[model samples]
Target: MISKQYDTIIVGAGLVGLATAYQLLKRRPSERVLVLEKEASVATHQSGHNSGVIHSGIYYKPGSLKAKNCIQGYMELIRFADEYDIAYELCGKLIVAISEEEVPALNNIYNRGIENDLKGLKLLTKDEIHDYEPHAAGIAAIHVPQTGIVDYPGMANKLAELICQSGAEIAFSEAVLGINEATSTTNVETEKHSYSATHVVTCAGLQSDRVASLTDRGNDLRIIPFRGEYYQLKPDREHLVRNLIYPVPDPKFPFLGVHFTRMINGGVEAGPNAVLAFKREGYRFSNVNVNDMVDTFSWPGFWKVVGKYGKTGMGEIYRSLSKAAFTRALQKLMPEIQESDLVSGGAGVRAQACDRDGNLIDDFNIVRKGNVVHVRNAPSPAATSALSIGQYITDQLFVN
Candidate 1:
């Protein structure tokens, strides 16, 4: 039976979904909006699982969604955090290069930052780099003072709170099982019941492509799950990192390889190297779902994409198995970081969209038609850009 009718139904109660709901209610105060979450609570997935680094729009191609949205969203996020008193610190971050070969790309990022309207971006030398983080060692580095850390889960919860207060309902433990476009409205079916709405917006993180597939358009681009693993510093080693420390990312891949980041609450989190997750939400090396593994391997698009980037795939898989290899990658940036300085941390899976031609869609991918809007692909920095993306999605769906 249809549970209830709503003006809008948003699938996934992650930050993006909640923010979209909040933004929806902002303009249409009396609109009946319902938010659905597979989990029992908000941010149980990527939003809660990430390292909580607030990005500064670095590394994104200029004029792209990530560039524009991340830059714009960072400011908006900081303001929102301030208004709500969410624990956050603009402690700044550094993007460093250990070799002379990496210096060119490092400068490219610096220039990109300037073009993106990011301020206080400085090229730092060895001694100057030590002034902020004593343990960090870089031959040349780009210092971005705007990047910071936040409590993402806390922020997600607050967004949910404000959502409920604005008269929107968040229905948790409700997995979206189906999507049906009825005459005038779209019906989203959950495990429990059916829900009808005037418009439907989906922001499922790990399951984004699967959700979109049910709607018809997302089938062209399939979601490939890549798990990012982190390691937290022991209590004694918390003081080693004052802010965020990152590598000058390989322009070819989607993730920023294992870096050190300081969380809003306390302590430091290191790593988060991108590896293909055996399960869609696989946290541990032992956690494997056979069907999920078979499903991913079964996709022809996945094989095509993997075949095109076999070398990169080999490195990620190798690093995933060998801690020493992973440590070796880390030592390239900070030579002093011993493998023992790290301990296992939770993992977050990214829903990467792959096209039929084996190309990875780096930009934010959104499709809107009729009464439904699908977020086909929203990778890294989506959290930072949630508010703006939310508004963007709403405008696309209703505002034309």
Candidate 2:
């Protein structure tokens, strides 16, 4: 096998990994930073398949890593997009309380926005909501004028460009098999090569827990893949949404319900429901890998998830198989929307970490083993918070 040595080795070439590499290279230009990706090209997983929405850090609790990084990442991402000329828009999003019961939740979200120091956030009256999205059905709404979408794959590509220009190397289609953490360095063995780094920070995403296990620190948690299936509005129905439109999310479940997003490409997408995935990268029902399923089934964490979320899990499965049921849920926010208005858009698998006791890990959790740091849980806003998260990871590596 090809042998190499570097100052840092980042596994996974998704947005987070690329961002980590970019930030590390930016700090110590002479340091050799190597990034490895399993895909033939970059961003074939969550980073590329995401809704592409630039989060405003609204949903996250104040003082959390998600909240802090998202706000900072937005600013950094804006600068990066401007620098690279990536097509993006700061066109706002509307979060609507569709019923009387949702008013308090709407207020809570508004307050969270305030705590996160968001500017231009407006809690609109029922009548005032019409001026923003005429077709939206709601009793009250919160206008987040900072929420936007961009090309994340493009962002990863741009970061890769920056890394290359800084003399760091990226090796794709190389899957990490083992990581031996030593007192002073980490030895990483991939499918095609072996490398040693003084320090290693992984953004493994889908295989995060597994990567951490290789470092001997992921014993307490396991990654459970949750597939988020999307649907795109037909061309004729593109005018239905001017920007991002959302419903007040279900509090019990970590999912933000079906919503509409106008992508940078000038088309609209809707309905990304969270369902349990059969495989780590299963985007569809037919794409099952027996080994993945068996591994998940064998894990105690997966059982814990089943015990806790059995009812919600069944509901998600029901909606996944029934088109009419899914449409009925979608109609809660957009009553005018018909089943025919949507077609299958791409799906993204979320690498959600569950504790041994079966509790879902909601925030960004990083645990270190020896000289290696493993990113255990980094879901939705990870791409949005890429740069800031990158900076944070870099800080953690050198600072601590």
Candidate 3:
């Protein structure tokens, strides 16, 4: 039987929300916890469609939420995989610098890794680079042994299974329409039914900003969706990439440049250049949503981002449209790669947060408004840091 109120209600059944529910139920097994998801199943958006890279805290600033969570979550994720018999590998990765100009940025990344307390980080010479990846060509590279890959969607499904086994209800295909915060309880109204809870935690991914605004109308933050398109290497060409290979990212932008990733299931994936999406959930160039486009155009931060990174953005657009352009970018690290070696693959939309001032919010932005907690911004390492982020949110709920 459904109760009028639950001890806690979590919105969004992505990895973060599911992790939060799992931790909460683990702490208080008898507490009535319920999870609500707009999609018919969990991990349908960002969590399900990510690159599946277990980040090594190399790019994040020390002490930032991203850095801390990624480091702690990396350990927790490996441990959980071990206990649950999930398939994951510490295959490691190489952040290659093809030119002398890129060496400074590469050094900065190494320093960040050191500051973030990562062990077994090595600086590889041009000759030594081939030791790990024979096809990779670079002037210098940072070999991060902690970097790895896994089947994230598989992990998420297992989490959902565990959540149900632990006696929690996960209602899917129930889109959240509004949130009404009262003195003692919060009411979450969906398309089909309504749920009331003492406290509500929303980890809505793509619709995070909009869902958050349902409760607090004064929010200045908006979600700007960016589509990342990927390409998979033909089976015969998979050997060109051993483990994972990445370029030293530009310091000015938040995106990691195109490279190669050896998936846990087999085969290699390459090239995910970031581009503006026409829809909030837009996966392809043709998949356009008028309202989503209008929202993006009306946002001040969106234009500011376009103006600031226009050149880079245009380059990304070019790469997205031209297979040759994307292959050329990948060739920086692996010169052996040819255009014919690539084939169309899946794409994912990132729910990037931007402020009213036209600034893209970088860190993990979680805000607590009364009894409602909102995860305003969580990108790249979010999937890798879900457990830690969940634990952090779980801690906040205990104090309340």
Local distance difference test, each candidate: 0.85, 0.87, 0.91
Selected candidate, larger TM-score, 1 vs 3: 3
On TM-score, the leading prediction is 3
Q: Estimate candidate 2's alpha-carbon lDDT, on a 0 to 1 scale.
A: 0.87
lDDT of 2 at 278: 87
Over 180-261, each residue of candidate 3 has an lDDT whose tens digit, in order, gives 9889899999988888998899999999999999998988899999999999999999988889999988877878888898
What stretches of model 3 exceed 4 Å from their correct place? 1-3
lDDT of 1: 0.85
Ranking by lDDT: 3, 2, 1
Which residues of candidate 2, in runs, are more than 4 Å off?
none
Could you give candidate 1's per-residue lDDT for residues 1-400 as a string of tens digits?
7889999999999888998998889878999999999999999888888778888887788899888888878888998999999888888888888778889999998998888888888999978889877888788898888888889899999999999999999998999999999889999999998999999998988888788888785478877888887777788877777788888888777677789888788777778877788888878767798987887787787888787777887898788788788888877767777789778776788888877777888999988867889888888798999888888887887765
- Model 2 TM-score on a 0 to 1 scale: 0.97
Task: Estimate, for each residue in 51-123, the C-alpha lDDT of model 2 and write its tens digit.
Answer: 9999999999999988988999999999999989988999999999989999999999999999999999999
Per-prediction TM-score, please?
0.96, 0.97, 0.98
TM-score of 3: 0.98
Index of the highest-lDDT prediction? 3
